[model samples]
Target: MQDKINRWLLDNALAHHPDQQALLNDNEAIQAASACQGNDAEKLAVFADHLKVSSQLIAVIDDYRRCFDMARIVFWLVAFLVGASSAFALLTATANHVNLMSVTLFCALLPMFSLCLWLGVSLLRFGQSDSISGGMLGRLVNAATHLLSKLMIAANTAPSVHQNAVFRAGRQWVNPWQLSLLTHSSWLFFSLGALLGTLFRLSFYQYDFYWGSTLLDSQQIAVFVQISFALPAALAGIPLNADLIASAQLDQSSIQTDRAVWAQLLLMSIVVYGIVPRLAFIALSQVKLRQSLKNLPDNYAYPLFRQALKRIKSLSEQSQQPMLAPRYPLPADRAAHTGANTIASIGIELDQSDRWPLIKEDTVKDLGHLINSQQYQSALTALESLEKPVDVLAFCSYARSPDNTTLKRLRNIQDIAEGRVLIVLCEQAIAESHQVDIHSRLIDWQTRAHEHALALVDFDCSHKVNVNDVLNAAEREQQT
Candidate 1:
C-alpha cells in the first residue's frame, strides 16, 4: 500500500512539478522513512497511523474500475463466443470434402478477422484520455436507436387482444419454434450438399442401380443433381433478398451489377448495421463510462474542510485572541510597507482575500447553499481557498480528530490545492499524538495521498488511543 501510494504521488508530482514540489518533497522523505521499517505489520502500522488521507476518492476510483472491469469481461466473453463459432464452421467445412466449401470458409473467416481488428483499434483509442466524450455521445445515440428499433418492431408485431391470448397460451416455455428453425436450416444445407455429392459420384462411376434405372435416366439424374444444389442456393437467397431491400431503402443508386451483387450487398449490410454497430456501441459505452468516472468531482472534501476551518477561525476571532500565532513572522523589509499600498493594490488585496477571516457559520451556510443548489464547482472553489496549515488541520480533526470522511475530504482538497498545505497538515496530525484510531486513519490517508501525489499529512495521534487496539476491541465485541 505504501509503495502504491509512493508511486501515485510521484507520478502526480512529476506531472505538476514546481507548483507541487514542496508537498512532493515532504511526502517522499516521509515515505522513505516508512519504507525503512522492514516488517509488513510495521508498514501497515505506519499506514494505519495516517489512513484518513483520502478514503472517499480512493473508494470512488475503485468502484468505477470494478464496473469497467465487469463490462470488459462481458464484452470479451461475447467476442470469444462469436470467434469460436466462426472457427468451428471453418473447421467443419474444411473436413467435409463438400463443394462450395471455399465459400463457407470465406464467410466464416471475414467477420471474425474484421471484429478482432476493430476491438484492437478501439482499445488503443480509448487508452489515450479519460474524457471519452465523443465515444459516450455515439453510444447514447446507438443505444437509443437500437431500443427504439426494438420497440417499433414489437409495435408492428403486436396482435389483437384475443389473438395475443391464444398465442401466449400456445407458446412453448423454451421457444421450441426457434430451435426448430435452427435445426431445419442446418439440415437443409447439409442434407442437400450430401445428396448432390452422392448423385455426382454415381454419375461419374456410371452406376446402374435399380432406383437409378427405374426412377430416372442420365439426363434426368443430372437435372436432379442440379436441382439439389440449386435448392440450398435458393434458400440462401432469402438473406440476400433482404439485404437488397435494405440497401435499396438506404440508397437505391448504390446497388450495382456484379456477379454476386446480392451476396455483397448482404455482407455489407450485416457489417454496417449488425456487426459493426454492435461492436462500436460496446466500445463507445466503455469509453464514455470511463470518462465519466475520471471526470467525477473529487471536490467532496472541500466543503466539509472549509466549514471546519471557518468554524475554528470564527471561534478564535470571537475570542479576540489568536489561538495560534504564525510560526514565522513576516520579513522586516515587508513589514515596513504596511501603509505603502496604492489604491490599485488595495483593490487587489480585497479581491484576493474575499473569503478571509473565515467564519465557520457563514462557511457552513455557504456549503449548505452549494449543496442545496448542486453548485459543486462553487463549493470546491470555496473549500480550496482555505489555505492556512492550522486551519486545514483543525478542519480535518474537528469531529473525532480523523474521521474517514474528513480524511477523504482532505485528500480531495490536496488534489485541488496541489500545494504544500496537505503535507503540513499530515505532519501536524502525526505530532499531536491523539487517539491511535485517528493516527491509523491519518496514516492510511497519507499513504494513499502520497501515492496519488495528493499531499500527505502525518499526525501521530495514537499515543493514548491505539487505533488497532480499539478496532480489535470492537471486533471482539462484534464476534461475541
Candidate 2:
C-alpha cells in the first residue's frame, strides 16, 4: 500500500496542478514540519495537522489504489482461467497418445519446453516497453484498468481528460517486474496442473514408456536424454547405459525397458524447470517491488506535498487566524436580466439517470467524456451554434473527489462557453457504497471548485429545484 502511494505521487501531472505547485517548496515543507516534536506516530499527527500535506497525499494514494486493485484482480483471474485451460489442453493431448507404450521423453516434456519459450519471449519483449504495450497481455492489463476506472466511478460515463491521462500515464510506469510476477504466478498454476494431470493418469493406467523420435538417431536421442535427466536420474540412483540406449527404440516389443526412469525424468523436469524458477521470480519481484517503495524519495522533495503546505500557510496568514476549514469561494450575485441565449446542461462524469435542471426553452447537451474528441466536439458544436454567453449547467457525481481533473475540465468549459457555468453535484444513489465520510469528500470538491471561482450546488435527493433560482443563476453571469 505504501509502495503504491509512492508511485502515485510520482505522476507528472501533479506537478502541473496549482495545489501541487504550492506544495513543492522545500522551505515551506520544513516550516510545516516544525510543528512535529515527537516519535514517528506523533510526527505523523503533526504532519496531518498541515492541511495541504494530508489532502494531496490522500488524493494521490486514492488514485493509484483504484488502478492497482483492478490490475491485481485481473492478474488472479488470468492465473486460474488461462492457467487451467493451458494445463488441461496440454495434459489431455499428452494422455491421449495412442502409443502410450512408447512415450518419448521429448514428447512428454513438450509442454514445459513451450512454456519456457513463452516466458523467454515475454521477458525479452518486456525490456522493450512500447513493443509490449499493444500486445495481448498489455491489452488485457489496459482493459482491466479501464474497467476498474469505470466500476469505481459513481457515474457510468467515461472519466474527464485529466482522469484518463492519469490512468494512461500509470500504464507506462507500472514496472515490468510487477507484471512479471503476474506471469510467473500463472505459469506456476499451469505447470502444476499439467504435472498433476500426468501423475493422475500414470497412477491409474498401466503403460510402458519408452523413448522414440523420427529423423534423429537413437543414440542422439539417448544423449539428449542424458544431458537433461543426468542430474535428476543420478540423484534418484538411475543410470542411462549404452546398452539401454541401443535397446530403447520405437515400440519394438523385444526392446522393452522399465518406465520408472522415464517417469522420474519427466516429473523431475517439470518440478526443477517449470515450477521452481517461476516461484523464484515471483519472490524476486516481490522483493524488488518493496525495495522500489522504500527507495521513493521523501515527501518534502515532492511538489504536491510542498504545494499542500503552501496552501495551508497561505490560508492561515490571509485570514489573520489559524486555519479552520478549507477556504471556499461563494458564488457572487450578478446583475439580473431576462434570459436571452441557450442553457447547456452538460453532465460531467454523470450517468443518464441523473436529472439536469430545465431552463425555459434552452439547449441541453449530454456529454459522457469531457476529453474524448467525439463528446467534446458535440458539446463545442452545440455551444458554437448557440448564441454567445450560453448558460452551461454541468451535472457531476458527488461520490468522486473533485480533484485536479474536475477543476481542469470545468475551467476548460468556462474557457470555451463564454458564459455562466454552474457545477451541480448529484448524490450517491447506489447502495453498498463507499465508506469515505461524505462531508470530508465534499470538502475536497468545495476546495477545488472554490479554487477556480466556479458556481457549485449539491443535488437534493428529491431532484426538486426552484425554477426561478435556476433561471436567475443562468442569467446572472456577465457576458464576455
Candidate 3:
C-alpha cells in the first residue's frame, strides 16, 4: 500500500512539469505505453520507470520512511524511560508512608482522564480528522518532522529532485490516525515500564500504604476505595474488604496493614486501566487508518491521466481504420496581411509530426516551442524586449489537454501583451474522426480562458490564423 501511494505521489509531482515526456526524454517510452492496454496506474508506472529522475525520487521516499520509523521508535523509548523514572520516584522508601491516593492519581486517575479527553476531542471533530492532529503528542511529532524536513532542505541533503514529494509523502504517512496509533502505542509502553519499575521496587524493599482526606471520613474513604478496586479485584481475585481499608486509614489507625493488597491493587490498576485501554485504542486506530488508506482518492480527471486515456482511445481508433493523408499540409505560410494584431507568433508544445500554420517570416517574429522553463524564459525575455506592446498569437495543439501549466503560460503571454494576447488552438493536427474529442477539449480550454478573461480562437491549418476572433471576443466582454 505504501509503495502504491508513493507511486501516485511521484506521478502527481511529475505531471506538473511543463512537458514531462519531452523534459524527461521519455517520449518513445510514453508512446509505446499509450499503445498498450492497461489501467491508468499501470501506464503511469511505465511512465515513471522511463523517467531519468524516478530512481532518485524512490530513494528519497525510502530515506524518509526510514527516518520516520526511527523517530517513532525513539519517541516510544523516551516515553518508557520517563514512565519508569516517575514510578521509581513515587515509590521510593521514605520515612512517611507512601500515599495510596498519590499512587492512584499518577497510575490510574491521571491516565484515565487524559484518555477520556483524547477520545472526546476525536469524536467531536471526527469529520475533520485529517485536519486535526490527535492531541498534544501528535502535534509534537508533526512539529519535529516539519523541523527535520526544513533542516534537510536547507542542507541540500537530497539534491536535483522535487523535495516536496518526499516531505508530502512523509506527512501523509504520519496522518492523524497514524499519529493516534503511535500515541496509543507509546502510552502502552509507558504503562508497562511503570509496572515493571513498581514490581522491582516492591521486591527490593517494603513500604507502607495509607490514605487520608480532611473532608472525608473512614466510611467514605472505604466506599470510594471499594468502588475503585471493583474491576481490578474481580480480574485478579485480590481480596478487598472494608476492614482492610479501615486499617490502612492514616487517621483511623496507625497499625501497619496488609502491604501485599495495596501493591497488588496498584499493579492491577495499571494493567486494567492504563495498558488495556491503550491497546484497544491502538487497534481502533489501526483499523481506521487501513480504511482511510484503502479508499484514498485517485483523480482520473487530472490532465496527465486524461491525456493518457485520450491517447489510448485515439490510437485504438487509428489501428482499426485505413491511414490517409490529412486534408491540409503541416506547414503553410499565411498570405501577407497588415494588422496591429500581427506583431508575433509563438508555438507552444507543438506536435512533432505536425507543423504550425505559419505567418510570413518577415511579418511576424516566431518564438520557438515553449516546452521547458529555459524556452519559456527565453520567450518572456523576447516579449519584454519589444519597444511597444502588440497582439501576440500563442498557438498550441488541440490534441493535448490544457492543464494549469498551460493556463499559466498563456496568462504570462497575456501579461506581456498587455491584454492583447490571442490563444490559437491548432486543429489541423487532429483527425476528422476526433471532432467530438476536439470540440470537448476546445470547450475545456475556452471555459478556462473565459473565466480568466483571456482572448482565444481556434482555426484549422487549411485556413490563415484568425486575428478577428480576439477582437470579437473583446467586444463581447465589453458588451457584457
Best by lDDT: 3
Q: What's the CA error at residue 367 for candidate 1, in Å?
A: 47
61-153 per-residue lDDT for model 2 (tens digits) = 465567666686666566545534543454455443323222223233543564566566766777573222122343466567666765664
Compared with the true structure, all predictions reach lDDT values of 0.32, 0.53, 0.66
Error of 3 at 238 (Å): 2.3
Give the TM-score of each candidate. 0.24, 0.49, 0.61
Off by over 4 Å in 1: 1-71, 90-270, 279-480
lDDT of 3 by residue, 87-194 (tens): 888887444478777777776666677788888887777787474346676567666666665655555555534667566555655678877887788888888878
Write the candidate numbers in order of decreasing lDDT: 3, 2, 1
Displacement of residue 100 (Cα, Å) in model 1 is 10
Measured by TM-score, how close is model 1 to the native structure?
Answer: 0.24
Q: Find the 10 residues in a row with the least total lDDT in model 3.
A: 327-336
- Name the top TM-score candidate: 3
Q: Kindly list the per-residue Cα lDDT of model 1 for residues 1-480, writing each as its tens digit.
A: 434433232222222222222322233223322433354334333332233322322332233334333443443444444444443343344342222223322333244344445456556666564212233222333344334433433434322322222222212111222222222222223323332333344234322111122445545544543433243344455333333323322124343333243333223333332344444444555454444434433321233323333333333343354332212222232211112221000000111133332222322212212112244456556655544221121112211223334445545543453332222232243333332333333545445444434323223332322323322332342233
